[model samples]
Target: MEDVIVPIVLFSVLPVCIWLVSYFNYRKRLTAHETVRHAIDAGQTVSPELIEKMSLLVDPIRADLRRGVLFIAFGAAFAVLGMMVNFEDGDALMPMLGVASFPVFLGLAYLGLWAFGHGNKSA
Candidate 1:
């Protein structure tokens, strides 16, 4: 029962955590935009630099590259875990490899996107 519960909680919590982070980030951006709107209504000069600083935009290609590396590393860690578990029990490796493949393929896709977008200014 504990084993089943632990896995269930872990998988469930991951999506919740991701959602929370995205929610908070959205709220932050909303607040920032509201502040800018208020300042504009007050007839204050809002400079482009100030907006740029507040926006904190990251390069999409660079972000993709970073995510790709991180996902690949994460997948590699899972693969290593699978190998270690396999040493203890023979049946664990294949299932873990199957699980690891998702992240690895996702990482490869991100890397491919990064590569394709690297040369394009609009990307």
Candidate 2:
């Protein structure tokens, strides 16, 4: 029972965490964009300072994605290893967890790419 529960929790909780982190990052970026919009509406010039601040806002997402990608790669490797081991013992949970990690990482990667590609709204 404990063995199954531990693996289940590990499999489920991590994906949830990854998702929540990505969601919060996206929300934060939207909030920052709104702030910039407000600043522009107030007749503030689009100075270098403002641009620099906006660029800084993306650092967190990039860091998170980099970390997420690494975890996904590691999870994939572990999943393959687990599948190989389970051939004899016949458990599928760990391999499932391994497969699940890839999407989370891919999502995070896409988020990063989107942010970087569209970051400059005021060119």
Candidate 3:
């Protein structure tokens, strides 16, 4: 009963929180754009720095690297946990490795893309 309730509440609440966050972020961006537009329409001079900051994008390489590191860490943790469980209970080793390998592979792929595409080879 506790297990069922926990998962149900967790899954439900997580999605609702995520949706609220996403909605708020979108609203914030829209508000910013409206403010900038309104300022310009009102004959106000926008600073170059503000324009630059607003136009800046999240660095893809950095994002990929972050995800890769996080995935690798999670994979390693799961793999280690799987190994410990296997040693203790003599079951779930393959399942654990299987779960771990998914993230490990995904992380490796992200890192590979970052190295080959985003990072400078000559540097």
Candidate 4:
């Protein structure tokens, strides 16, 4: 009963929290952009420097590498913790391994993306 309740709460809460945070952040940025646009429309002096910073380019390689490393770390932690846990009748190690496989596989996929000429994209 406890196990089912915990995962259910976590799955629901985590996503909703993330969604709310992202939604608010998006709204905040949108508002800031709107303010700058309004200022410009009213013949107010807006900072071109701020606009330049807002239009910054993202480097995909750095992002992918960061994600790959983070995912791999999470996967390793899950696997290690899974191993250290004692389950009833030793019947659930497989389940733990299954859980661990998700991030490990995802991390490997991201690393593969990094390897596939992402470094050359900016050149």
Worst 10 residues of 3 by lDDT: 54-63
Tens digit of per-residue lDDT, candidate 4, span 1-123? 998999999889969977996797678678777877898999998777876555432345655777798889988988777777735436656777788899999899888888884758652
Every model: Cα RMSD to truth: 3.1, 6.8, 5.1, 4.6
lDDT of 4 at 46: 75
**Candidate 1 weakest ten by summed lDDT:** 52-61
Candidate 2's residue-wise lDDT over 1-123, tens digit each? 999999999889989987999899899889988888998999987888887878777765556556667766676776776677778878775766657677657756755764775565452
Range of the 10 consecutive residues with the lowest summed lDDT in candidate 2: 114-123
- For candidate 1, write residues 5-87 as lDDT tens digits: 99999899979988996897678778888989999999999999988677654457876898899889888989999999999
Compared with the true structure, model 3 gives a TM-score of 0.58
Show pairs that collide, candidate 2: none
Off by over 4 Å in 2: 1-4, 60-123
**TM-scores of all predicted structures:** 0.69, 0.46, 0.58, 0.59
| Clashes by residue pair, model 4 | none
lDDT-based ranking, best first? Answer: 1, 3, 4, 2
**Winner by TM-score between candidate 3 and candidate 2:** 3
Alpha-carbon shift of residue 101 in model 1 (angstroms): 0.9
Best by TM-score: 1
**lDDT agreement with native, every candidate:** 0.87, 0.74, 0.81, 0.76
User: Ten consecutive residues with minimal summed lDDT in candidate 4?
Assistant: 53-62
Ranking by TM-score: 1, 4, 3, 2
